[model samples]
Target: MADRDLRDCFLNTLHGKAVDKVPVLSVTQTGTVELMKKSGAAWPEAHFDAEKMADLALSAHTIAGLEAVRYPFCLTVLSEALGCRVNPGR
Candidate 1:
């Protein structure tokens, strides 16, 4: 499964159903510094900008072969949601 095409496999795995292969999923995939530079979507900016966040979040799917991507990126997202400032860097 290659990220965008693994929706059914992911859902099936969650439902305790068997799949051809285990879906490679992650809610905490880090966007490397190189990826940020390549995509022009820095972490600090991405945290606040939806487009930047989406671009950075898709890096893993496009480059790493993740079976799925956590939309808007899911790194410590709750902290921001709970009114805490997220510090820059991985």
Candidate 2:
């Protein structure tokens, strides 16, 4: 069977559909120092900027050869939104 699209592969797997292969996904922060330099989608800024975050997440698939992408580089966003002080370390 042919491989499904990346999104479909992920969804199908969740729904217990038969897929040719399960997608290798990070499901969280997938960035690495190496991936940052290679894809030019580094951290710090990417964590805050939606565009940069998307770019960095996509790099997991495009550059790191992962089958899927996930977003929000860190958990600080939730804490910040809940009025918890966030440091956003440099």
What are the models' TM-scores? Answer: 0.65, 0.78
What TM-score does model 1 achieve against the real structure?
0.65
Location of the lowest summed lDDT over 10 successive residues in candidate 1: 67-76
- Candidate 2 residue 20 Cα shift, in angstroms, is 1.7
Per-residue lDDT of model 2, residues 1-90, tens digit only: 223577788788999999887878776668888888877767788887777888888888888778867778777778988999887777
Model 1 segments more than 4 A misplaced = 1-5, 71-77, 85-90
How far out, in Å, is residue 58 in model 1? 1.6
Count of backbone clashes, every candidate in sequence: 1, 0
lDDT of 1 by residue, 1-86 (tens): 44444888878899999888787757665577887887788867887798998888787667666767676666467788799986
Q: Which candidate wins on TM-score?
A: 2
